[model samples]
Target chain A: MRYVLIGAGPAGVVAAETLRKADPGGDILLLGDEPEPPYSRMALPYFLVGTIDEAGTYLRKSETHYDDLGITFRHARAVRIDPAGKTVALEGGESVAYDRLMIATGSRTQRPPIPGIDLPGVHPCWTLADSREIVRRAAPDSRVVLMGAGFIGCIVLESLIKRGVKPTVVEMADRMVPRMMNAAAGGLIKKWCATKGIEVLTSTKVTAIEDTGEARDPLRVLLDRGAPLRAALVVVATGVRPNIAFLEGSGIETDFGIRVDSHLKSSVDDVYAAGDVAQGPDFMGGWSVHAIQPTAVEHGRIAALNMADGNASYQGSLAMNVLDTAGLVSSSFGQWQGVESGESVERMDEARFRYTRLEFDGERLVGAICLGRTDQIGMLRGLIQSRVRLGDWKARLMEDPQRISEAYVASTHK
Target chain B: MLKSLHIDPGKCTLCMQCEMACSYENEGLFNPAKSRIKVFDFHDRFVPYTCTQCAEAWCMSACPVDAISVDHATGAKVVSDDLCVGCKVCTIACPFGTVNYNHDTGKVIKCDLCGGQPACAEACPTGAIAYVDSDWTGYDKMRRWAGKTDSGAAQAHA
Candidate 1:
C-alpha cells in the first residue's frame, strides 16, 4: 500500500502523518515543488518583518523525523498527474506509482497583469522563497507599495510597519478584507492601521510601475488618480488561486478548484483532493469556497481517514479568516454578509477601534466578527461551529462575548 | 565555582517563549526578533538550536572593548551595552552562532540565563524546554526512562 501525496505544505504533511498513524504499515511519500520542507505560510510576513528568522517559518517536522516515520520526501516539482494510470509524473520526466493519491497542492499567489511586474523587487508572500526575497530587498526606511487590502495584504502591511518601513497599501476595494469581513470591521481595522502611521489608499488601483533612475530606490508606482508613489519594494498580497494547472484534461472536474464530494473524493476514482485545492460544499450554505488553511487541514485528515478504510465524511467548509496584525487580533467566521437574513447584533467603540458583531439567523449564530478583544474568538468560534442557539443570552452576548459563550456552554450540559 | 546555562534542542518547539521572555525582561516589550537568544529552526531537520552558554566562552574573549564579561555566579556571558562599541567581534568569535549583534541599538546581545531564572522554560506549554540546574540537566530524561523501565512487570510484559 503506497500512498503518494503531492505538495509538502500543511495539508500534505498532515495527510501523510494521519495516513501513517492510521495505517503504519503503508508506505508514504511526500513531494513538494519547493526545495524546503513545509513551512507556515502565515509566518512568512513575520519573517519578512524580522520578527522571525528565515528558518522560523518551517511548520513541518524536520526531515530526519520524516525518515524515522518512513515517509519519503521528494524535493521536486510535480508537473503532471495521470489518474488513469495511477501515476504522478515529475517535472524531470520521472514517474511515481501510488495505490492511493492525495492532491494537496495548496495555492500560489496571483500576480496582477501590469507592466514592469517582472521587476526584481516585486514579491508575493505565498512561499518561503518569496519571504526571503522580500526581506533581502527590504531595509529600514524602505517604501513599500502593497497592492491589496485583503487579510494577507494587511498582514504584510503590519509586518512592514514592524520592520520600520512605511507601506502604502493600494486596494481597489472600498474596505479591507472585504471578502472575509464586513465594512464596519474593515473600517475599524483601517482606523487602527492609520493610527499606526500606515497610509492606506482605498478604492485605488496601480496603473503601472515606473523604473526610477536613482540607484538606491529603483521603482515608482503610478496610481489610478493620485501622483506616483516612490517605492523600493512591492509586496502583492492580492489573493491566490488553487494550484490546479496540472489537472488540465485529466478529467478530474474543477470549477475554480478541484470539486470534491463530502468524502473529499474527486470525480475520478482512487483520487482525493484536500487543502486549498478542494472546493466543496459550504458548511452552512452548500456553496463552493476556497483558500482556508484550517478547512484544508481538516479536509486532509478526513480524506486520509476515509482513504485508510475508516468511515469519514467532510461535513462542509465554513468561511473563516483569522488575522494577527501589530498586536491586534481579528477573526471572522461563517458568513460576513447579511444575505443569510440573520438578526445582527453589534458592540462597538469607535475611539478604541473595537467592534463585535454576532449575526443570528433567528436564534442560532450564523456568523460573527471580532476585533480588538479577540481573546474570546476561540469560545465564539466553537459556538459558530456548533451552530448553538443564542435564545435568551443573545442580548448579553452582545455586551460580553464571554458571558454568552459561558451560558451557551452551560446550556450544552443541560 | 560557576554553572553555565544549557538548552535541549529536542524540547524546543520554536514557539519563541524564550525570545519573548528575554525581550520583555530587557526591553519592556514582547519582541522576539530583537531578543538575545534566537531559536534557529532547521526545517528539513526538525531541530531548533540556541545558545549553549559555553563554559569556555569565546564571545567573552572576542570582545575588544571588554564589554562582554563572564558572570562569576552563573558562568553566563553578559554583555554591557553601554560599554559595547558594536564592533561585533563577539558575534564572529562564538562557534555556536549564539551571539548576535543588534543593529537597532548598535550593540551585541546574547542569552544571560534571564538573570538565573528563564521565563521561556516557564512559559513552554509542552515541557520541551527547561531551565535545569547545570550539573543535573539530564535528570528529566532519566526520570522518564525510570518510569518506563524501572517496573519489573513492565519489563516482563515487554
Candidate 2:
C-alpha cells in the first residue's frame, strides 16, 4: 500500500520507519519542504554555538539511507490535499495517490507585530538557514539582543555564551521562562542569570530595531519603555505557531493545531497528523498542547501503529522543558501555574548552589522544577507520570531529598 | 603545543555524558543543551564528533582580545572568562567548530582537556572516547596489532 507522509521531521521520520518495521513491503513516500536531509531541529542551537559541525546536525539517517530502505523521500511542499480524490498535490503540480497519509507539517516561528522585524540581522531560530544567518552575522564583540526569554530564547543565550557572545534577553513576562516555570522557580532562574552577568529585562518588550550604518556596529533596540538597548544582531524567539493553514478546506479539522484523535488519526480518511502541528489532548492536564518533541515522537509511533493495524493511542503529553544555562540546570513539568491545594517540597543550599522543588497537588505530584540538583528530577517525573500517591512520603519529601531518591531507587530496583 | 580533546568518532555512543559533565562543571546542571563539548550524531552513520584541537589554532589567533591562551601544564588552549570579552570571533575562526559561546556567562567554553583528565573521557560508557598522551595515541593501536603478530599468538601456540 502507498503511504505518503507530509513532513520529514522527527514525527514523519519515526512514522515512516515504524511503517517499514511493521510492513517491509510498505511503499512509504516521505515528503519534506527542507532541502537538507532530516536534521535535528533540537540541535540547531548547538550548530549556532559551533559545538556541532554542519554535517553533525543531520538526524540519525541520511537521505541515501532512506533510499536503501525503499522509502521514497521527495523534497517538495504539499500545496493542497484532495481528501475526496484520495491524492496529495505537490508544489510542482504533481499528484500522488496514497493508501494512507500522515500530516507532520511541524511549525513555523511566530513573529510579533513589531517594527523593523523584516530588517537585516533580525532573525529567528526556526530553520537551519536562520541559524546559519545568525552565526554568519555574529562577531566576538557584537552586541546581541534577544527577544522572548522562553525555552528557545534561553537556549540561544546558552549557545551564544559558549561562542563568547554576551546576549541581553528581554521578556514580555515578569520572569524568565514564566510560562513553563512558577514564580518561585523563575525567581531562582533570574537570580542565576544576574549572577552570570546576563542583562535580563523582565516585563519589558522590544518596539523596534534601528540600524542605519554597517551591520557590525551596535543597532539600537527601542523598547516599550525606558532607553533603547544597542546591539549588532537581534533574535526573535518569542514562540512558534502550528502550520495548519495548508489544511484549510481539506475537511481536516483544526483548532490551535490539526486536531487528532487518540490514535493520531485526523477526521479525514487515510490521514494522520503529528509533531508540533498536531494538537492532541494533554496527558497530565487534559488540555491541548502542540510543541513537545517527546509527544511528537509518541504521536509518530501511534500513527504508524494504527496505520499498520496495531492498537495504540496518543497518550497526551507532559509539557516538559529542560534548560542548561551557564553552570545551571533548569527543568519544569506539568502545570506550574494554577495549583489547587498546592504542596511544595524544596531542598536548597546556597553554598553548593543546589535547589530543587517538587510541587504536589493533594495526594498526587502534579508539577516540579529543579536547578543544580537534577538527579531527583528523573524520579520526580516518574511520580508525576505514575500519579503515584504521595501517602506519607509527601511530608518526608519536605525535609529530605533522600526519601524520594530511595523511593526512586526501590521502585526501579524491583 | 596546545592540548585539546581528540574525539575518535568511531568510539562515540552519543550518550551525552560529556555534555552533562561539562554543563555540571561549568553551569552546575546536567543540561546537554548548554554544554561546550557538544556530541553531534550523524545518526545514519552513528558518528559522534567534537573538537580536534589543531596545532595551528585558528581560535587562538582569531581571538581579538587575546583572552584565549595555551596552558603551560596541559598544553590545552584555555579561554580565560574574566579576561575574555563576549565576541564570537574565535567561534567563527575554529574550522573544527569546537569553540562555542555561553549566553548565560557571556564567555567562550572550549575543551581545556579538563585539566589533563577529561570528564567526557571518564564519563563515556562505551570506551569510545579516551585521553592518550599527545604523541602516543596511535602507538596504542600499533601495540595491539604488534601483540597479535609478534609475541602473543606465537607464545600461545608454543
Candidate 3:
C-alpha cells in the first residue's frame, strides 16, 4: 500500500512515523513545502530567543530518521489533490498516486490587510525564516512594535523580552489572549507584563505601518488610538487560518477547515485529515478547529491508526493553551468560558499574580484557567478529559479552587 | 527479562527515601524538590507517584522536537536533556502529570526508571516499590492466592 502525507509539520511527521510503525511494508511518502528539514513551528519562539539553534527546531534530531524508517520525505508542495483519481498534483507538474492520503497541511499566518504590512521591517513571527529575520533586526534595547496580543503574540512577547527588546504589544481585542483567556485572566496577564516593564496596549489595533526611511529604526506603527510608535521592527501575530485553499472543489466538506469524522476520515474515500486543517470533533460537543499542538499530535496518531486499518476513534480535541509571557505562566483548558447555565468558581490573588478559575457542567469540571501555577496542572486536563463526577469534591473545589490536586486524586482514585 | 517498577502505595510509610534516592541518582543531589518521583501527602495518606512508562506514551508523542524517547533497555520514556528545548509541551501533554519542567536547567525532566535498576525500588525500606517483571507485576500476589487455594487434588494428579 502506498501512503502519502502532505505538509511536514508535527502532524505530518508524526503521521508518517506512525504509518511506518503500523505498516512496515507499506510505501510511505512525506511531502514538505519548506526547503529545511521537518521542524516544529512551535519552537520558532525559542529559536528567536537564542535558546536553541535551527538544528534544535527539527522534529527529529537524527538527519536520516525518516530514511531509516524507509519513509521517503520529499521537498514538494501539493497544489491540488484529486480525491476521485487518488492522485496529488505537485507544484512542479508532478502527480503522485496514493492508496491512502493524509491532508496535514497546517495553518498559515493570517496577514491582516493593513497598509504597509509588506514593509521590510514588518514580518510575522511564524516560520524559521521569519525568526532569522527577527533575530537580526530585533537588537537589545531596541523598540519593537508587536501586533495582536493573542496566544502567539504573548509567546513572541516573552521571546522579545528575553532578547532584551522594548516591546509594545498592540491587541485589537479587549484583553490579551482574548480567544483563549477570560477577561480577568487576560487583565492579570496585562498587569504582569506591565510589572515587567513591557508595554501592552489592549483594545487597540494597528492602523498602518509606515516605513520611516531610516536604516536603524525603519518602521512607524500607526495605531487606531494614541500616538504612532516608532520602532526598529514590527512583528505581526494576528492569527492563522487552515491551509485548505488547495482542497477547494475537491468534494471535501469544509467549514472553516476540512471537516472530519470521529475517525479523522475526510468526506472523500481513502482520504483523511488531521492537525490544524481538519475541523474535527470538539471535546465539548460539536465540531471545531483546535489549532493547538497537543490536538495536532493526537489527531495525527489517531488518523494514522485508522489509515492503517486499525479501528481507532478520536475522543475529540480539547482546547488547551499554555503561555509564558515574560516569566508569568498561564494556561486554559477546554471550555474556559463557562457553558450556558454552568456554575463557575474563581480564586484570584492579583497581588501575587496567582489565579484559578474552574467551570463546571453539573458535577464534572468542563473547563479551567490557571495563572502563575504549574504544580500538577496536568491534573486539570486529566479531570476534564476523564469527565469523572466530582460529587462532594465539587463543593470542596468551589470553596477552594487550589484544591485541584486533592480533588483530582479523590475523584480519580475512587 | 524486561522489568518495571511495581509500586505498592499501601506498604509505603512516607519515609521519603525514594525521593532522595531518585534525586541523587538523576540530579546528583539529595533534594526531594528536584526528585523525579514525588510522594504527595493527601492529609491522611501519602502516595508516591512517578511516570508509569505508558505503552502509548503521550509525553513522547506530544513532544514537538521528538526529545522524549523510549529507553530500549528499560522501556522507560526518557527525555533527552540536551535536545529538550524546555517548551513544556510534554508537561501539559502528560495526562498523569509525571513529566515536569526543571526551572533550574531550563529543561523538562521525568522518571527514567534509573536506566534499569530503579533507585526508588532499591531505596524503599519496606518493599513498597519493587522492580519486577514487566508483564507479571502481579505474579507474587497471584502466587500467594494460589498458595491459599492449594488443594491435594493437584498433587494427586501430578
Candidate 4:
C-alpha cells in the first residue's frame, strides 16, 4: 500500500516510522514544507537559549534515518488534498497519489492584527527561522516587550531572562497562563516573576507598536495604559491555530480542527488526522484539540496503528501541561479547573511559592494543579488516567494532600 | 536468554545496598539520591523500584530530540547525555516517574540495567532482587505451587 503523510513534524515523523514498522513493505512518503531536516518546534526555545545547535533540534539524529528505513522524505508543501482521486496537490502544481493519507499539518502561530506588527524586529517565537531571528536581535541588556502570557509566552519569558534581556511582559488577561493555571496559581507565578525582576503588566493590552526611527531601540510599544515603552525587539507569544485551511472544500469535516473519531479516521475513508490539527476525543468526554507534544506523539502512534490495519482504538487525549517558568516548575492535568458541583481543595504557601489544588468528581481525581513540587508528580496523571477509586484515601488526601504518592500506591496496587 | 530484574519485597531488609550499588555503577558515587534504583519506605514496608523497560517506552516516544534510545544488547532505554538538552519533557512523559532529572548534570537519568548484569540485583544481600528470565518472571512462584499440589496428590493416594 502507498501511504502519504504531510507535515514532517513530530506527528508526521512518528507516523512514518510506525508505518514502516507495521507494514515493512509498504511504500511510505513523508512531506515537509521546511528546507531543513525534520526538526522539533518545541526545541526552538533551547536553540534560542544557545543550549543546542540547529542540528540538535532534529527529531532523528542520524543523517540517513529515513533513507535507512526505506521511507522517502521530501521538502514539498501540500496545497490541496483530493480524497476521491487519492491525490495530494503540491504548491508547484504537482500531484502525488496515495492509498492512505495522514494530515498531521500542525498549528501555526496566530498573529493578531496589531499596528506595525509586520515590522522587522517584531517576530513570533514559533519555528526555527523565528528563533534564528530572535537570537540575532535579542542581545543582552536590550529591552524586549513580550506579548501574551500564555504557556508559550511563559516559556519564551524564561528564554529571554536567560539571555539577560530586560523583558517587560504585557498580557491582556488578569493573570499569567490564564488558560493553564487558575487565578491563585497564576497570581503566584506573576509574584515569582516580579521577585526575579521582571516587570509584568497583567490585565493590560498593547494597543499599537511603531518604529522609533532610532537605531539602538527602534520599536515603541504603546499599551492601553501607562507610558510607551521603548523596545529593541517585541516577541509575540499569543497562541496557535491548526493549519486546516487547505482542507477547506476538500469534503473533509472540520470544527476548529479536522474532526476524527476513536480510529482517527477523517470524514472521508482512507484519510486520517493526527497531532494539533486533529480534534479527537478528549479525556473529559468531549472532542477538543490538545496542542501538546505528548498528545501529538500518542495520536501519531494510534493513528498509524489503525492506518496499518492493526485495529487500535485511541482512549482519548488527556490534557496535561508541565511548564518551568525560569526555575519554578508548575503542572496541571486533566480537568484542572473544577467541574460544576465538583468538590475542590487547595493549599497555598505564598512565601515559598508552593501550591496544590485538587478537583474531584465523586471519588475519582478529576484534575489537579501542582507548583514547586516535582516528586511523584506523574502519580497525578496515573490516578486521573486510571480513574482508580480513592475510597477512604479521598478524606485522607483532603487533610494532607502531600501523601499523594502513598495514596496512589495503596489504591492502585491492589 | 534475555533476563530481567525480579524484585520480591518480602525478602527486602531495607539495607539500601541496592541504592549504593546502582549509584556507584552508574554515577561513580555512593549517594542514594543519585541512584537510579530507589527504595521507597512506606513506614511499614520498603519497596525497591526502577525502570521496567517497557516494550512500548513512553519516554523514548515523547522525547523531542530522540536522545532516548534502547540499548539493543540489554533492552534498556538509555539516554544519551551528550544529546540531552535537559528539556525534562521525558520525566513527565514517563507515567511511572522512573525518569528523573539530575540538577548537577542538567540531564535526566534512568536505569540502563547496568549493561546486562544489574548492579542492584548483584548487591542485594537477601535475594530480594534477582536477574531472571524476561519471558517467565513467574516461574519461581509457579514451581512452588506445583510442589504444593504434588504433595497433596501423594497424601490423597496414601
Interface RMSD of each: 20.0, 19.7, 12.2, 12.2
Candidate 2, residues A18-68, lDDT tens digits: the string is 789877888999999998887667667778877556665665424477877
True contacts recovered per prediction: 0.00, 0.00, 0.38, 0.33
lDDT-based ranking, best first? 3, 4, 2, 1
Worst 10 residues of 3 chain A by lDDT: A405-414
Q: What is the lDDT, from 0 to 100, of the residue A97 in candidate 3?
A: 100
- How many steric clashes does model 2 contain? 25
Between candidates 3 and 4, which one is better according to DockQ?
3
User: RMSD in Å for candidate 3, one decimal?
Assistant: 6.4
Single out the weakest 10-residue window by summed lDDT for candidate 1 chain A. Answer: A405-414
Per-model chain B TM-scores are 0.73, 0.76, 0.84, 0.84
Note the residue pairs that clash in candidate 4.
Answer: none
Can you write out model 2's per-residue Cα lDDT over B1-158, one digit (the tens) per residue? 43334456566667788889877876788998666665654453334344445443546644433467777888778887755545444553343445766666656677787777788777878766677667645323322322221211122223
**Which candidate comes out best when scored by DockQ?**
3
- lDDT for A85 in candidate 4 is 95
lDDT of each: 0.70, 0.71, 0.86, 0.86
Clashing pairs in 3: none
lDDT by residue (A1-414, candidate 4, tens digit) is: 999999899999999998998899999999999989999988888898988999999999999999999999999999999998999999999999999999999999987898989998999998889999999999999999999999999988889999999999999999999988999999999999999999999999999899989988799999999999899999999899999999989999999999999878999999999999999988888999999888888788778877887777676788888787887888888899999888888999999999999999999898999888776676677678777789998998899877777777666543
lDDT of 4 at A113: 94
